[model samples]
Target: MTTSYPAQFLAVAGTRPEVIKLAPVLMAFAERSAEAKAALGVTGQHRNLIDAALNLFGLTPAFDLNLMRPGQSPAEFMGRALVDLTTILQHHQPRPAALIVQGDTTTATAAAWTGFLSRLPVAHVEAGLRTRDRRQPFPEEINRRTIGLLADWHFAPTPRARDHLLAEGVASERVLVVGNTVVDALRWLQQRLTEADLPASARRVLDAGYRLVLVTAHRREAFGTPLRNVLLALRDLVMSFENVRILFPVHPNPAVQEATREHLAGVEQIQCVEPLNYRQFIAAMSRADLIVTDSGGVQEEASSLGVPTLVTRDQTERPEGVEVGLVRLVGTERRRIVAEAAALLGDSTRQTRPDRPLNLYGDGQAGRRIVAALLGDANPPPPFVPSIIPTNSSDECRYESTQDRCGFQWSGPRHSRH
Candidate 1:
């Protein structure tokens, strides 16, 4: 048997969110021939979850590292992935022209670093997102910052994200404000999904004339005390309102699973089940009256669907949704969560406002723009210009000099020509 390498771009994904965001870019590459096609490399940071997302997009990886293990630490995973990725880059026939990675994960950071060590040009997708506080999101903030320093091209998802890179002194020419590919993925999934595709647990709530509050909380920051507060708040909400029901798709993480089982297992009006596949999750989100989550991807998905959302975090990298009134940051405080959820549930008008201008994240053509940029076409797609600029909060680049607070010095011009 002979193995043929058809990949010009070696796109890598380790988690479900990475798979979702990268799927659009891979699809875009598929439309082209000869030097434009990409081959996927799965790091298996999230095993089953990554498989479900890959299946949803009809994608198969050219290489699978299968690195995930129960009770694995980020440091351990990074060490293993770095060695495996290096072997792939060195021995693969017709080495990939560029190494592509998405979002802020240990896998992405490791891959970007490996690419740099291998002297390969690295292109970062969904780049330039920052919460500014490294400890808040733990490791992810630092992982993305490291990638920013190493990547040759930064495919920023919004004007805000591009500005963050510029503030950090990254070359403006290297950063392109391509809209978020999550919107592209969401739009593609929504076209094929229907009400019947929703999980049975979700459908029962809607049929019973009860307002459904879909919940998802799995961030490392929300592991112990914060997660318990959120679960307690959900119990309070259900006990307080007769027409309210909760549907939480529990993450497979041991910390999250333990907390969920201890606080929410066998609780009345709350359906705690295993994680739903991408398609069923999309169907569930569409019919959800309100969403409470700490996942960044869910924030974008809920906002795009016009489903009112309450973010259970102190800060978010994706603040475009908050710039509009569609999303609110309630943090992990029990009282705050209950108050916000109650306020939205009590008012029927706040549930789903489909008429709101919710294209702040994207217009679903981000995949095409990314492909044009990667191919170095003569005419690249125009940059995604957001209609709504943030005013309520200070989202601009706050660095006073060429050197930022983090000690990264910018050598290029501050303003972008594009």
Candidate 2:
């Protein structure tokens, strides 16, 4: 089936990270225009800014599973997403030969499971990224592990991730260390950018030779007091660095907005921009002198561009960047966050930029490797697979054994459409 539709791919993403990392892979399919259709299905988990990102890539979702409620729990979100995406899966004409997803989100988790049930081969991009300590990343750690088990092809981003999978027992032949696709997306965004594409407010802010210090903090741990501390640090930085322009793409969550506004409002140097489009975002990050973010994707992005990152969280899954000197885990430590950003800013002038440009992920070719491996040409790598009910029981789920997992018998359409 992979060979039969070499260019066809159904790249599913709903969260910002999934959308960002999967953008390049999705673009790969779209670039093949005549040979493929890279259909996008948004489970509406993080639809807040994804459309702008998709527009940046010049792509739109074929199906939008607007499966988000104002206040939804992980349990509620995943359950709703699964139920909704199932119907879309049933209706998608010329259903994809492969369903691709990146990282771990309820959308990815639910979609991968639905695809697995529908008997479509699921390829997990950036597969097997683990913090070892599952509790640190909330549901994501579990989601990736679950997807690792459900995914027919695991496209791991690093040897470390691949090794983690092998140590726990995934078949070596099914895993492929295809590096991270975030850089490919970043590169794509860079290539696709035009000054005209930028929002007027963002472009005006960018033109003034202001050292851009991007601040994005939205981790579960940093909700109450921790959020205030990070905000305080930003407040101090903006006042201290006169030419420093802070473009905070605040999280859509209301609490985040209120908390950030409490400390960061009415500051002249601080230009709090809306969550940028993906292409403009890449352009912004590439030009940024220093980044203060708690996002796992930003860690990888900062690493890829060699932009020094000050992580506002206490921990991260992609510490490969920190280990390699591209990022510093400042961990919401107010003074440290301020100081690190200050230090990086002090060192990086227009001329002598401290370069840490290493492709820790890969050579920006993960999608091709993913498609190549899915076609059954060569063995891929391995990722962490938990000791669940033995897979030897083919009696329970024949879909796992067959190529057609997507054609489930849904006599009536119950799930809603977007």
| Residue 222 displacement in candidate 2 (angstroms) | 1.7
lDDT of 2 by residue, 42-115 (tens): 87787687777667666677667777788788899888888776776676666678888878888889989989
> Per-model C-alpha lDDT, please?
0.85, 0.71
Clashes of 2: 12
Which 10-residue span in candidate 2 carries the lowest summed lDDT?
A: 394-403
> Model 1: residues >4 Å from true position, as ranges?
1-4, 349-352, 355-357, 388-418
- lDDT tens readout by residue for model 1, 254-281: 9999998899877889999899999999
TM-score of each: 0.91, 0.81
Distance from true location, Cα of 415 in model 2, Å: 56
Best by lDDT: 1
How close is each model in CA RMSD to the real structure? 6.4, 13.3
Worst 10 residues of 1 by lDDT: 393-402
